[model samples]
Target: MGADRGRRGGRPVRVGVYVGCGALLLAGCASMPDSGGLSGVESTPRQDAQVRVFAKSPSKDASPAEIVQGFLEALTSDDPQYETAREYLTSSASQAWDPYRSTTVLAEGPNAEAVHSGTSEGTAEILYRLSGSKVATVDTQHAYAPDSGSYSRTVHLTRQKTTKEWRIDGLPQGVVMGRTDFQRNYKSVNKYYFASNVSSETGGQLETVADPVYVRKQVDPMTQMVRALLKGPTRWLDRVVGSSFPTGTELKKGVKSLSPDDRNMVTVPLNQKADHVGQGQCSKMAAQLLFTFKDLTPTGVDEVELQKSDGSQLCVLTEDQADGIASHGTAHYPDYQYFIDGKQRLVRMPSSGSDKQPEPVPGALGDGDKKLRAAAVSRDESSAAGVSTDGTSLYVGSLVSGGSLGEAVLHSQGKTADDRLTTPSWDGQGDLWVADRDPKNPRLLLLQKGAGSPLVVETPSLDGRIKAVRVAADGVRIALIVEKDGKSSLQIGRIERGTKSGEPPTVSILELRSVAPQLEEVTAMSWAGDSRLVVIGREQGGVQQMRYVQVDGSTPVGTAPSALTGVKEIAASEDERLPLVAHSQEDGIVRLSSGEQWQKVVKDGTAPVYPG
Candidate 1:
């Protein structure tokens, strides 16, 4: 049982709930995508997008069961204001109810059963037990995290003397629905933030980090987005990313509807706390807002104007101005997708070029003098890091002509090639990361600027040895494959950095959470979008398969790539427009573009990669 919350209620007439005949009927299902492959059968939306559900107001002298059923049905309707849903509650309960505090998603529609709890003031009372298997909870921040266990909440209803109707007097905060209804009502949007400590070292350029959240698809998304942005990033990302908005900043008093004006600009009137920020900090806040609102629509908002509490314009930021303040990984589309050809040398081909012949890069790794086993290219495409064929040596050099691969920068003393160094990866900061899997001394190392002594990253909470590591483009988060007891699962860890000047920055991986707990083994994965990853793994006793999992552990619908066999390495770009590339043992390098099947890129190539 959960805590008792909210106000009293009365039983009223129901609209579409018909449980007496048999099983409960579900209405207002959302239309699904055309591709039709769902992460799970129950998770897919079934409502027609064109069909709008108009909830019916409660009727007089409704039963307790009818009132409870009607409100649950109303929660899933398309009635924008939810006026009909409120009709089921008493006047005081209706006024006190807040449906958006949070949303609890269950594996199926909640089952409400009524039992006589007691009576007060010569009126009968009934307690409705709402129960189901909990799947996830979308917090007030709109963040989603996987959950399990049974859910039970008691809703106490009392009979009214005036109407003789049984209305709920006490209920839990927030709405509760099944997975299908959640899929119909809410959508995922990326909220952006700036990377801390990086601009301090790189001269004041904020790299944007995306924090994804779920919001109602049809409601006033602009206003909801603004409110969420003001609250700050989600808890999982709070330690690593920084928001430009000052603490306690909020929408100005009496400011609710925040639609873009006729001039295509959104004027956000903020409280007194945000009124005194400097121009640079103000622009950074507006830049984060702009990036966050981009997910609302294509043309809803082009500029953001921050207003003081007194309605004075504090600052206005256009799209171009916002870009100058912060850089998303998509600022420059990559020129090529790189890989090691049959000759064990680094090579590249145009990213969008169709079946073009691969060419050796103009670098030491491509000079045919070094037989490499694995490699990584800097985000800017200016440098490359390669591991020797034996996997004991790691070499970093320039990617331009005349660039030389000097002595090996790092070495591993693992007994075998498989136990040496994992494939290296570069972050947007131009730093390199790799895990040394030596049985004698295992460590996760970071090469600052791909040079100097490598720094061993601290991971006090890691229970297993690191199998593979992929740093996110923002450098605030990392995707790690951890192996323990012969199984490997995918985990995301926040990269926290120290700020004291002169001393080497203290870097540690904190709050590690498993994003694919069901998978028995995760062989390879890459950042596919702002907070999504393309993962290659399979469940226990299951066949190998590939799918996309959100950093927060929710599986998105209709976006999984086509199935492939024997995938040794997989690569995806933060720029979601690019196709997914993978090196398959049977098919060599293959690519999967949207709405298309996997196409072969080569017959013998291996280790395909896109510049981070």
Candidate 2:
């Protein structure tokens, strides 16, 4: 659903199911190579010595006028040589288009006439008109058939400017096929060309002619525009990745010498530095996106940031109210601020739009509403952790208002104005998945809003606390990180079609021992693919790190220390290899698309806000 592309832009109209009933007309249009500008009539002419002489036969030796007459005669006289009409056309005209694929020369009137004139370019133009009993053929192999309707066609013939020889250039410009009314007795020239590949059932469509070539002409500009638009929510980035970050901030900033594959840690010289308020006690980790404001210079948007653990410097700076930061409570308004602890938190920025009530679709919730209520009562938030993609309504988590640990399902889309889930993650499909901790059980319960039943998936081990849960594709798999025993572990599970609960449909647990040991709790979890996961934050070393782990067996497959020095926040690009890192020294965004080709898109010290 997220990958859907836009169709043609125009006024919507109800089209009939069947559209092949209209009469097909013989109209002419032209296809020419991209030609350079033509000179004035007085420009020197280049001689064309390649013209072929006609044979002595009466039909072959006919002049341009006679040749046009013969073409008209064959259409109405039913002459046997009609099939061999090619014998009379000039070699240039015959080679211009594939007769088998070109005009079928259907029916023409016996009174058809050809008018010829010479142009300044030394080409003779021909206009042919006919009506009644003209010869026509559907395809090359088919015999000419008699037809009744009268029709007209205009053709262009170019003579070698120097030799005064003529040849056909086919259709003229004004008659090409396009949108027009069918009721009128007008003939529109239409051109159709097709190519196919066996690898796919359908072939891609490409226009033979496109106006304003600018659309496809500049590749670099288009690439930059697309990259900028896809730079997701910016406000959230600033929240998570702050200005002054620690040395090991997973997302780092680099200078002109940055590489393509360096994921974490960027280096910057003081002279060309970003606006850094010096290093903070917290570990800064950020994923920086090279961006440009609509009216400003190039900048980078940090999507995720891991601030230092110490309390000296504030990791997030935003207009969001400060109180919401301490209690994990709802923001007073649309934007708010807060601090992040050791737990891994995935924060997505809110989109641009007015504050409208969430709308609820009756069937969208399925029969799970009741189950959600029963299950939410056991958890504790007053507001549901998830909502539909439409934003029409909101779902209350099992845990709300510090209330009793029982299952409860509350709707906030229209009724409640205050409490709403913070940092919600969507499954790419329509369903939203949220994380809720169970007081009695040490496991984290995943509250799903769109499933048939109010759904919940708990971590296998009750010893660890669940911090984050991410869904892949359309609810196919759920990836989460659990912090237990001062260590963080990654968990993967699949959703079963009919199951209600207990040991989720299919589950696998992987502990993050390699990255951190004592306080090695996971800080962030991002899914690069179904089998791959990227985790940020540190454990024992006090140094922030970005680890790429394969979920198949719960182990680390690769690790990249952000070359970015003094990192603040780390955000991963859609491509797993390229990680954007923010630096603390100067307000800068370093892109690690590779280990060698590092480019700084934003050098401003503006820190992005993450879900605190």
- The TM-scores of all predictions, comma-separated, are 0.89, 0.28
Residue 380 CA error for candidate 2 (Å)? 30
Residues 255-347 of candidate 1 have per-residue lDDT tens digits of 868877778888899999998999888888888888887766755468999998889988989988887777775664788899998899999
Worst 10 residues of 2 by lDDT: 207-216
Runs off by more than 4 Å, candidate 2: 1-422, 438-453, 458-462, 497-519, 553-561, 564-570, 577-592, 595-612
For model 1, what is the C-alpha lDDT against the true structure?
A: 0.81
**Per-residue lDDT of model 2, residues 423-451, tens digit only:** 34444223455544333432223334333
Best by lDDT: 1
Alpha-carbon deviation at 330 in model 2, angstroms: 35
RMSD list, candidates in order: 6.7, 27.9
Assess each prediction's global lDDT (C-alpha) against the native.
Answer: 0.81, 0.30
Best by TM-score: 1
Query: What's the true lDDT of residue 361 in model 1?
Result: 96
